[model samples]
Target chain A: MMSRKVRKYFSFTAFVLPAFLFYFSLSLLPTMQGLFYSFTNWHFMNPKYGFVGLQNFINIFTKDRYFVMALKNTFKLVAALVILQPLIALLLALMIEACAKWLQKIFRTVIFVPYMISTIVGTFMWSFVFRQVFTQIGSSIPLLGFLNQSWLSNVDLAFWSIIIVSLWHGTPLLMVIFLAGLAGVPVQLKEAAVIDGAKPSQVFWHIKLPLIFYSLTICMFLTIKDAFKSYEIVYALTGGGPGWATQVMTLNIFEEAFSGNYMFGYASAKAVVFLLIVLVFTVAQLLLMKRREVEL
Target chain B: MTRRITPLYVLNILLLTLLALIFLFPILIGFLNSFKSFQEIFLSTLSLPKSWSLDNYITVFQRIKLLRSTGNTAIVSALAIAGIVLFGAMAGYKLSRTRTKYSTVIFLLFISSMLVPFHAIMIPLYQMASKLQLKGHLPGLSVLYIGLGVSLSIFMFHGFTKSISREMEEAASIDGSSEFGTFFRIILPLLRPAMGTIIVQMFIWTWNDYLLPVLMLLDMRQFTIVLSVNTLFGEYGNQWNLILPALIMAVIPVIIIYIFFQRYIMQGVLEGAIKG
Candidate 1:
């Protein structure tokens, strides 16, 4: 009946309106306002401001030295993560898969413990290790004296420290994803490959790699997004210290708006630019990876 | 069946054990050092604690108001996650079951917003929070989290609802059950796995979130666990005894949660990554 149809439609509205209402006001509206604010000179404190058109964006590209440094650092970190995250994750997944069942579970659990810890906590713990514990060890054990360098103070080492800490915390989730992908690899296919006198390495190269390429794509995409958006690790660990040597884009944006300078409009522009870069990078990576996924 | 171990298997076990040790070294060191006095830690960061004392923990507990902040975190995470689950479930199930243009549009609206990272909107979000008087309010922050979190929750539920059949709802409707009754009594109970996955994922997220709380929580008493521990770093520079104990206390609960819900958490990670 028409009444039944009307009631059904009303139920759909009833179900959806609650979430939509919350999402629209807080998420979507803020995002849209951010986009609008990007074009205006909106300071956090000063109420009187005028339209700036593309001035904020132009300044970011040409004049903002800090922004450029942050951009360079973000790219460097993203590049490292894109390559190393998948490599280490896939390697660990393969290693775990080859283990006996119980060992696999234990190893997976142990590695994933870091990922469960808050990034702030994990990074702080690593900070102590890099700052105090490593130095102590290096002094006590002469052979390990190389570890005594100012890990978070020296410019180059600090960058790498961020990468190391990021990888330690990030790799496990991707490894688990890789594990899931590897689990889906048919036992029959691998067994068949082995029966055909294929070597272990050969089976991995010819069979397992292709089958898990989808997971590889997903991991790469996630890595790029996370790397570009990386904040807490660098923020809590180094505070972009030693003269902003390791400031990433997110940190740069936060500093621009909140830390000292209340340049809300300029920060909005930087944020928009950062968002565009993330979108372009992730979308491009997804496209590139999609083409290489082996059809089963 | 009895299986013969190979040289390769021996190598695998050794390599895995080594990697596991490397992964766990920081936490192990932190745990050991947390029990040490400041002077003891400074004397030898590598050595086992001279005395396994609870002094630092007790000091940290009082300093950070551990129970109060954790209770605050629990309140926020619980309220946000509950709203997300209930709202996401209802909307996602209905959208999946409905065959209408409006459903498609609404679904698209939810999914597309997932791409906007928090950084992009954080400035304006700060403004909105102040305007709405949600700033520095704990329950208000939870409401904001529900708003921020619902997109992904809805996305997951939408994907999950596809794997569920509509026949049960139809059966219930034929039996003259109200739609709300049918959903709450039937569809929801069957959505336990997806619910488990989201609950674990969101709990970890909301519990450990630092940036949002930092932005929203203005008062010291409003600090969540991570925020409280973060203050330790600033107030006690290189005071390893206090900082390490607080960090340990902050991190240990989530590890315990992970131990219990490891499967769901990992599954959620895989599902979220692949789907997103």
Candidate 2:
């Protein structure tokens, strides 16, 4: 028994120690340091620092317009994606599924191609399109003169531009999830619903919708998560632009840390707050959606 | 019923097609714009240029030391993938099979980390790296990559390895093989598919990553492809000719690698989506 215990203990450590050390030192250390620095007024340049309790959080709440705007924009984006985007994606998915088998893959590929591009690439593509091509198209067409707007440069338009581009890049992911969910839905149920003399709306509202409730919930979680971590596209497009109008939390944290004199501790506080917001949003979404998930 | 579905479907398809065209438009413009002279790219950024030229590619290649930067990126990414897969698999095997208090704790730590955004700790991390003198070099970059990548890599491996039988391990051990040899000869071979997927994923992420490279690589010489792309944004003239080509050239290798590993790479991502 002693020998058996020794053998297992040795083998486990041999397997786990190498990875545990690296992961702890690099990933866990940074996380812990973030927690520590959140309590201190630590700047990158100044090596020596004293602990400053809750001042950063207070400043952000009281004085920091940037953090306030970021919080507002993040919530706004989350609401839009969770509420509006999914409806559009679901419609697209249902339509495509009902459309035809022959063209099923064609639409899927067309929609999903955007998801493959990096955020930087996606934002860059839209910048070129909105600023150049959209302008050109708008200017060329006489009847559609009012439709053409400068999307990226204007503060009012930039937020929507980010949202639209996000939908363009991200809707396919929803479509894919919905497609997977749609495929999982048994065909026999629809036939049963039809035989029961139900109207199309009744059949859909009662049958197809309830079946893919899990998918909707998962998609909502993903959409919210992506919304909070919305970094690269916003950063690339306007640099939280037009005087901090579009600055989300990630942008605020980045600008706080790297762009100016490094308020490392202050940045840590902002990041923690951002993390808490994301956590609350995610947990709330999960709880809300989990109630709707129909058990098989 | 299907016939009645046609109109809505047709409208949807048409809308999607138009969207796809718009989606594809920027890259097309980027491609065409690359060939146009800087004067042409700026003057008629929207229209087709009368004369196509190789000046942009030529300029970027000459000015940016394109080959050297590519070599640096390739080497760093390759080493990163190698370390991530090997270490992730070993660690995953242990945690999945063994029932220990530490295993649960370690696994939870790794999994919970997937939610934390990198920016949260990036400054402290940079400070740590600076303190350790692991700054602006290949070894330093690869070490950082391993740290960032291992959690997800291990998670993937854990899921894949969990589906396998422990009987194989016992059989190999009874044949007088060392535990390391058992893993190397048997389990590693069986895990080829998942590991292949992880390799391609780790490679692409490490290669295309812009932020870490910029933050770490202080020297102009160590600039990766994305870093070099920013070099095109100069104070004067802003060299769209040079920049466009640099962007195109940067993506070319990525395109090639993806094409080669496209199937596995896609499955890898799909698999990772569930895990992530």
Candidate 3:
């Protein structure tokens, strides 16, 4: 007969083994291998490769202007999204909350519809608007004539075009999150503050904002991370084009490995750097935000 | 509170109504234009279509292999969700129940790697998939999803299991039920809410995902709706008549599912955000 401890161990093994095997093979192992490969001169065609310690990293920093441009563009997108998405979402959520009950549900559902669509589809849909619909409107209305700019082609305009598409695709979720956060803010607290002769804005500032600081942090973190890793929209809307105008970090890494030079090791190094940036920003934000979360 | 319609309230409603219209505008245009001939769309996009025609959708449906790609998507989603829900539940429940140091370490190992972005692991994963003969295959892609997805699933399950009582499992064990038997017969049914959340989340993710499938599946027959639609767009860049209908078709299934499960989807998003 088996000892009781042996049986317990066996059960644990049986339960955990399936998940661990897949996770290790697909996720953990690849991550470790990616790190290792970043230090080598690996190529798909060549069977053999040699360690070229730090060359990939050095090349990305010193030699590759497109990589540098992509990095800057990613940060720019993150900055724009981190500020704009939450602000718009929070405002819309507050408005929706204040609406009639039936209207609130209808508005929330309608607003979130775009988010349910695939990113590629949504981006394509917006591209049509930017290309055709806006031009039609621009020609018909004298007052809105400026609406006809080449949204996806001209470099400066393309950045904003990508941002607009990303915002449209991304904001609905944050709005829903903010709406959920708003629901958690007790009505009694707002009523109590109002009974004390506080203005609506004052009550919102003093009571509601603190109560939903946790949600704000979450929304901001999501926006930042998502914007930094922006791909499908940029890929569909502009193809990171009119010459790399909207290329973000993920697109850069993808092109490096797959599309352009097929430099797998070099792309892995960029991916590692990308991962570190994401980790640092996300961890720092979480730590800073967690401390500010109100107990109530 | 008095039911007074102040200027502030009027402005708020108007502003919100305008914003809501803007939010709906793109999809509205896409839907409207999908029924228009290319000439009609080019002539006047803002107006209602001159005549609502089924020609665009008919052509797109015939050309894009919508039914086949949708089936492929369904297959991938089903296999991935099944593996994720089953294995994630097993690991999560055991990790939560067992108090051993090893359990703690194993649980942490899964949890900590949740922060690694997919791009960081994409290159090596592609290499691994190729080496393992998983490249260019749908079932192989599903297995990769299980690996990439299990961490978050396990985390969710682990947290959920903590909220439920353990007495039932213990009693079943006392009555000479094997551990697997206890899990399957007793505990799995009890995890309905969590299973629902994970299944919906995984389905939406795997269905909408563009990058992974693009990397893994090289064959046209293996394309998901997103991949097929992307290919259609590339082939017919300026052909909005064809592309818009395909776009609408690509999103139709998800939108239908969303409408039916609106409440659950909203709750899942909020819960996932807060928990993660």
Candidate 4:
């Protein structure tokens, strides 16, 4: 007979093995292998490569101006999103919360409908608006003529166009999160504050916000992570144009590895850098936010 | 409270109404203009179409092979969800129950990789896919989805499994039920709420994902709806008529699912975000 300890171990293996195999092969192993490839001069065309020892990393920093620019653009986008999305979502959630019960459901559904659409399709739809509808509106309406600006083509405008679309696509989720947070804010506490002569703003500041701090952290975390990983919106809307003005790091990595040069090793190095940046920011954010999270 | 209309309330409602209109603007325009002829759309972009027409829809339906691509997407999503739910539940349950050092190490190994961005893994993953002859294959793609997706699902499952009592499992074991049978019968049924959340989360993610499929799948015959729509956009850059309808069609399925499962979808989002 098998020993009890052996049986326990066997059962554990039997249960976890399938998930581990797939996760290791596809997610874990590839990540480690990608890190290993970053130091080499691997290309898709040639099977042979030699260890270049941080050449790719050096190039990304010192030589590859595009990668640096992409990194800057990603940070810009993240900074914008980190500020705007949660604030707007919170404002909207507050408004919706103040509304009558039935109106809340209707408004919530309409707002969140955008989040249901695939990013590619949603971006394409926005492109159509920017290209055709805006131009038409500009020609007809004298006051709205500025709407006719080439949104996806002009370098300056293209960045804002991506920001606008990302906000549009991303805010609904945060809004819903804020709404959920709002639901957890005890009505009695707000009423008590009001009875104690606290104004609406005062009540919100003192009572509601503190209660929803956990949700705020989650929303901020999601927005930051998503902004760093922003791809499809930029890919579909701008294609990292006009002249790489809107290229985020993911797009840069993709173009480096797949689209043109097929520089797998170099791209892997950028990916590693990208991973490290994301990890640092996410870890720092979580650590910082977790401290402030209040228990009910 | 006074049953009277106040200026501030009026202002709030008007502002919210305006915001709602803005939120719905893109979808409204996409749907309305999908019926318009190109000339009509160009002439009055904001106005309703002169007459509702199905011409664009018909043309795009034929050009993009919308039905075939939708079928491929459904198959991919179903297979991936099946694998994710099954494997995630098994592993999460086992890991949550077992408190040994090995289990803790394995659990940590899975959880620590949760923040590793997909972009970091894409290149080598692509290489590995090619090497395994799994690139450009749908089943292979589904397996990859399972791989990429299971970590978070397992995390969710692990957290969820801790809430249920362990007495039932012990009783089942004592009643001569095998471990696998106990999980499948006793434990799995009790995990319905989590299962629902996982199914919704995985379905939307797999169904809506664009980047991985673009990298992995090559043939036009195997394109998902998003891939096919992207191709149509590239092929007909200036043809807004075709593009708009295709976008609408591509969006319709998810919208339908969302309408049906709005409550569950929202709950899933909140639960996943909070727990994750």
The best candidate in terms of lDDT: 4
lDDT of each: 0.90, 0.77, 0.90, 0.91
Q: What's the DockQ for every one of the candidates?
A: 0.83, 0.48, 0.83, 0.82
- Residue-level lDDT tens digits of model 4 in B128-156: 88888788879989999999999888898
Summarize candidate 4's per-residue lDDT along A26-76 as a digit string, tens digits. 999999999999999999899999999989999999999999999999999
Worst 10 residues of 4 chain A by lDDT: A185-194
Instruction: Candidate 2: give the clashing pairs.
Output: none
Which residue runs does candidate 3 get wrong by more than 4 Å?
B1-4
* Higher-ranked by DockQ: 3 or 4: 3
Query: Which window of ten consecutive residues has the lowest lDDT sum in model 2 chain B?
Result: B230-239
Candidate 3 residues A21-55, lDDT tens each? 99999999999999999999988777889999999
Off by over 4 Å in 2: A99-102, A191-204, B1-5, B234-239
- Give RMSD to native, each candidate: 1.4, 2.8, 1.2, 1.2
- After TM-score superposition, the amount by which residue B42's alpha carbon in candidate 1 deviates from its true location, in angstroms, is 1.4
Stretches of candidate 4 above 4 Å error?
A: B1-4
Write down the lDDT that model 2 would get: 0.77
**TM-score of the second chain in each model?**
0.96, 0.92, 0.96, 0.97
Model 3 local distance difference test score: 0.90
Model 1: TM-score for chain B: 0.96
Candidate 4 chain A TM-score vs. reference chain A: 0.98
What's chain A's TM-score in each predicted model?
A: 0.97, 0.95, 0.98, 0.98
Model 1 residue B6 CA deviation in Å: 2.9
